[model samples]
Target: MATYNLNDIVLGVDIGGSHITAAIINLKEKKEIKSTWNRNLINAKGTSHQILQGWASTILQSMESVETKPEKIRIAMPGPMDYETGICLIQDQDKFRSLYSLNIKELLAAEIGYDPADISFHNDAACFLKGELYGGSLYGFDKAIGLTLGTGLGTSYTSSGKAEDADLWNMGFLEGIAEDYISTRWFVKRFYELTGKQVADVKELIDNHAGSTDFYQVFSEFSNNLASFIYQFIQRETPLAAVIGGNIAHADTYFMKETQQELNELLGYSFPVKKSFLGESAILLGAGAST
Candidate 1:
């Protein structure tokens, strides 16, 4: 290992079910190198080679935007993956099936130009919470929880400034698991049941029907469902604050207030519920926090 300046750069990659975003970061400054953020859509259902190609292409583009090569690369990868060993087990998840049991670190390093030892991995959900704990909404809190409400539900908890996976997405809820009511599929299903029209995602519905009664009703139900889930989590974990992220959180204005109100009534007091300030780059920064 060689010593470097505090401002030395590292590459951070945030991989999701649909895309991979790569950025160059100045670790000490906690900021991304200007113009170095690059992203590419990945076909989650594609073959292993195609998926790896997408990651390599986007990462190379990000690397090209900077003048110097990075000493390390930290990846925020989605599960089920082995973060410590770098094995990818994304089986039966409708994505990355071909890469099941693959050693991602070795594969990615072979696909790109980095030593396997120079790369590290963390769970995407855990990184999300870690980012908030490191520099985003959960700063200064001794304990916190994070939720990512996207294609699926992601939960994590942090205490003493370190984050870990909570894995509460499958915890028992109403008719099924918490994820059944709190995920993208749930929103789409509920919205279709309410309006008899189908929309691709939560953003589409929010964008197309901002002021409609049905839209408001749909979001109201969403807020309640989310609040109920949060109540369960809070009672169990007892964190100081809860930070919500992911694509559905992009429409915070539509459901946040109601969720807060519901929590207030349920808890008999106000609890801090924050929107993710770092947006898409949170997990990227979190993945590189240890660098």
Candidate 2:
């Protein structure tokens, strides 16, 4: 099949546990194209099955207002999915348990009145890498990795201007991979147990008290673990640099700089750490780029 052309209007959806964010992308522009969204989040609130109906209805309705049928509708969902099979391949229930039991592509296409051939699927972090490379911060970088240190550690690797599935989640990265140590859930749980304080968000912890005893410990430990993997990657794939994104990269003072510093200290090599060029719309934009 011929890839969707630069002139086509592709719709991208960033399906998170909290909300389904959507965008209408004109590939010809390659920058910020038209986009909008609905704010109702169901699955994160334990209404996992309901999210399918909610998203299908909301996305199709929203697409109508764009005045474009979108030659392609590309979606970014949680990891462990089979892109070839066009089905979610879930291994755990941290989120999207209902999707774990559904053939998401068929269900979505049947309900949305679109042919399966008109859609594309990618893990969310892989989508992030595509967005970053094709439209965001790493626009000119030849090779890079996009690491999303969000609720879990979302990771993607890119080379030669294309994206790939490298879901390093809990895969024993360094000591034990992402999600095992350095995620918001993990940090916040450690914070609650260590400080006995009811923190609102994990960013708040890094923002307000990064210098504190607890965050200092976790931050360094996480950085060190990340560095070991970076050093090994240097010995193996050796990409030019790595771009860190998602909610955690906002704490550049905590992880981004430190991650790079550790890379240098541990490996005697230097590489820049870039923040995601696109903001909240990155994953959707990237998914659109993939389509």
Which structure among the candidates has the greatest TM-score?
1
Name the lDDT of candidate 2: 0.71
| Number of the top-ranking candidate, with lDDT as the measure | 1
Give the alpha carbon lDDT tens digit for every residue of 1-291 in model 1: 223354577888998777898888788888777588998888878898999988988988887755567878999887877887889977755468888999989989988988999899888888899888788887788799999888778899975567888888778999988888998888889888988999877878877877988888888998999999999899989988999998889989889999999998999989999999998878888888854
Residue 234 error for model 1, in Å?
A: 0.8
Q: Report each candidate's C-alpha RMSD, comma-separated, in the order given.
A: 2.8, 4.0
Q: Candidate 1: where is the Cα deviation over 4 Å?
A: 1-7
Poorest lDDT segment (10 consecutive residues) of candidate 2: 31-40
**Candidate 1 local Cα displacement, residue 18, angstroms:** 1.4
